[model samples]
Target: MDTALQTKPCRFGDKNTSDIVICLKNREGIPKRFYSHSSVLINKSKYFANRLSHPGSNNCIDIYCSEVNYDHHVNLLRLLDLPTDSILDSFDSVKSAVGILQLAVFFQCEEIACCCIQYLEAVPWEDKEEELILKAVSKLGPKAMPILARIQPVDLAATKDVFISAVRIATSIAGPCPPFGNELKTSAQEQVEFMLGEDEDAPLVTADEEVKSVLRMGLSQIYSSFEKELSSLLLEPDLVSERAEEKILHSLCDLEWMCNILGKMDLMKDFVSNWAESSSNVLGVVENNKLDSFMWGLKIKLIEITAKVLEAVGYGNVILPTPIRLTLLKTWLPYIRKMKPLLDSKGSQETGFPYKMSEDLCQSIEGAMVTLVLALPSNDQADILADWMGAEQVRYPDLSEAFEVWCFRTKSAKRRLVEGLDGAGNATVSL
Candidate 1:
């Protein structure tokens, strides 16, 4: 037994008796040097073995490498410091593994090279790190791939571009049909899609079943997350955290964006309808809601989603059954009254209240409901207006004020319409 080896770890490469000096450099032409022993480098790398064969009778050699990443090269030296098979004995992080792979291939260290490739293969690459690993592998090319035969850097870049284009098309402000639809009909976008080789030409109907399944699952998860979020928000006494509210809204918007891309307008409508139905179902609890602050804040958020969905789908597209219709309108009626002076005068200024929806969202819901009503028979419209006013016997001064604003404006408009019809009738009789 070697008593010296048993008592203390052997410092083969870093010891004072090291026979070679290795200098490495980065892309910026800065160099990093390391102490090396000929035996270790020779046995581990055939390239090093051939290159470092003869230095001088003084038994010293210098090896400089300009092709390696400085950090990667340093890591490679750390791996070489240990027995070759033990290079992967400890897994630090995926990042370090990838870097080690790059260095192993560069130095022609076959044993550690095998371990690096295996480590990458066995583990998952994080989404954020996917492109980084791909780029590293691309730079290594055939040298890094012990398992695969070849890879195309251009193909990788093209695939990445396609992914980015898909995400952009998915998330951009959608047209009526939304997502990557009808927008491709425009020559400029068509040309752009064509240049990028994006398959805008392919009909969505032909989307692979696997793809559709994944999309459906994604939408389900989003809705589940939204439901959980509502509960979380409800638990908070003061849903006054604007940032938190904005984050929740943005996440819902992201899901809507996906729906737009999938041409799932029905899906979008169904969510709002279901939410409204769900709201109605939970009315007892809501009325019994002890935490008025959370209840009021939640009502405002629910109204925001409902209003946006209706506004976005256009009034004619959605059938707002009387209960659901009144539910939405009543939600905003107080705010409407509060903003009566501004809304009646059609002023640009906004109104605010503690338990109120944002002015813009309140206006959107009000406008959506108003447009639906205007398209109805005048009698039906009036009855709807009556219900708005008569929903409760209490002093709904806000509701009264809101109705007065609408009644005066709509009555004169209707009067002018009646006069025109009467005038046309008289003219027809003469004819």
Candidate 2:
């Protein structure tokens, strides 16, 4: 072994310089080691030797180390006085790059981790690289969030199978081995929450101009897919109705996912707002039947998702476009108007109404109305609601209790919506 390799174990560690030296010497078929100090030695020795060594020399080191061995890599980088960014640039594969990022995070090397994450963001999400990508993300854990954010514009629909595969892989990465093992399940949940939240745990990496360009392009592609899907569903109401409720549910679920992604970008707000408008238009076309039920369900989802977007925008300090308010009110007005008869119709003996039918109908309508009202920009809508309340109270004086119940319901809804919208409004105003 060379004198540099033979030096006292202090630099590497006290216990086993021989094993370290042996690992470095043979450099063949090393099955992924995670020794903290070994990463330093391997990185340092390679750097000095690489600088002085011949360009075509076959004397290069090949060490197997987990991505989590980044702390050691950082120490090595420091010892050899190498720019961490330059060291990251040496990685020729996503796996290697991710491994270095994992180490950078593990060793508290923020700048290097940021750089590696930026690099990962530049590469497209390929089907063939799913496993490698998952492994790298798993090792980096929460620190990988920034990279995940950067890849938001990738064509998930084109890579739907791969994307689903990645989700499964991410679940596995966050696992407890036995399906829903406690540790893994908890980790996975935390990861989902972190990625979904505006206040993410990971720091945002400074992306290059090309990465930014690709992200914008990718996001536009995603929006196109969304537009295409929405258009298909709208044009073929029969097709939507023909599909099983579960299938429709699946599409809605995917929309929810898209909403989350759009929520992050700040660009998708208009798309989502437009979706709400289009959803309202379809509600009119839908006649009373199973199709109506599906449309109602979809409308409910839109309402919920719109609220979430508003909340997110408020947090991001992004001022919502004015049209959102008008679009939201227009979308919801028809549903509110439709609820009136449903609330008034009394059960009869010939064509029996279901038990609690009136009450349940009233509640559903009230809930939907409240959600709609809250989503509005709260200018003079209180008078509109008050007028509706007074008219209902007089029309159903015999059912004064129901009227009071409706009023209470409206009040509760108003409070909740106000609180949510107010918070969001404050955020927007501040921003």
Candidate with top lDDT is 1
Tens digits of lDDT, candidate 2, 109-169: 5566667777787776667665666666766667678766754554534444333333333
**Where is model 2 more than 4 Å wrong at Cα?**
1-201, 204-248, 266-268, 271-273, 276-279, 285-290, 293-299, 310-318, 321-323, 333-383, 390-431
TM-score of each predicted structure versus truth:
0.48, 0.34
Name the regions of candidate 1 deviating beyond 4 angstroms: 1-11, 14-19, 24-35, 50-71, 90-96, 120-131, 139-265, 271-295, 305-309, 312-314, 317-354, 382-431
Roughly what TM-score does model 2 have, to 2 decimal places? 0.34
lDDT of 2 at 80: 31
In model 2, the clashing pairs are 70-103, 175-184
lDDT string for model 1 (382-405, tens) is 776776666543232223444565
Per-candidate RMSD, Å: 13.1, 18.0
